[model samples]
Target: MSVVIEQPKSPRSRKAANWEKYGWMYMRASGAILLILIFGHLYVNLFVGQGIKGIDFAFVAGKWANPFWKVWDGLMLWLALIHGTNGMRTIANDYAERPMVRKVLNYTLWIVCAALIILGTLVITTFDPCIDPNASTYLPGVCAVK
Candidate 1:
């Protein structure tokens, strides 16, 4: 006797948005971009400077003073946070047997991610290299008087 297997999922409707597909695509795109951003960040901070010994508050202040670095770091922060949260969401969907638990977990994950991204972006944008009390010690060029 011949047997026929039924289709697992119904065809998607044109009106409905495919969030899973979008999320999957986002993971791939963000992951590739994150690799470049992360590696470049490491190369600049570690190799271009005095290596590990050269990293300090002053180094961070100097880096944040530049708009380019601020934007780069912001991008890295936002992308990484979202990518990680999406990954966690996927895991929850896969492993969590209860629907309510999965929903709660995903909601909590996204909320935390949103909070961190907002705070991190604010830090990057509002960072004042010259805000140090010991200006000469932390950022000699910008905060110290000549």
Candidate 2:
């Protein structure tokens, strides 16, 4: 007599390049990058120059004024946001059993992530130093001087 065997269910089709595999790789990569970026940010903000006291609106404005910082912040923004979102997506997929509910939640997550990323990039890149120069309270010193 021949014995019968059963195959376990897969979340995805066998023929496809697995998104979960890519997501796992991304988690590792982004996590490594995040550690470096986060530590650099902490060091600069908490240990360099005047430290915490130096971190006012002017400080942020000055940092954003530089292309280097702009790029750094943009990278941090995108990587961290996507990493966090993907992590949550993993959790949601694991817990949410209903197909319709999972689909809705996942859709919401992507929409929110996209919106935030776009808005953050726009804010970082297009921020003006003279939007309201005379409004010193709202303006950083750099902006107020303009």
Best by TM-score: 1
Off by over 4 Å in 1: 1-12, 144-146
Q: Give the per-residue lDDT digits (tens) of candidate 2, residues 77-125.
A: 9999999998888777777777777778889998999999999999998
Q: lDDT, candidate 1, residue 81?
A: 99
TM-score of each: 0.86, 0.80
Model 2 regions lying over 4 Å from their true place: 1-15, 133-146
Count of clashing residue pairs in every prediction:
0, 0
Candidate 2 least-lDDT 10 residues: 1-10
lDDT of 1 at 141: 62
Best by lDDT: 1
How well is each residue in 43-106 modelled by candidate 1, as lDDT tens digits? Answer: 9988995987899878888787778998899999999999999999887877887777877998
Give the alpha-carbon lDDT of every model. 0.82, 0.81
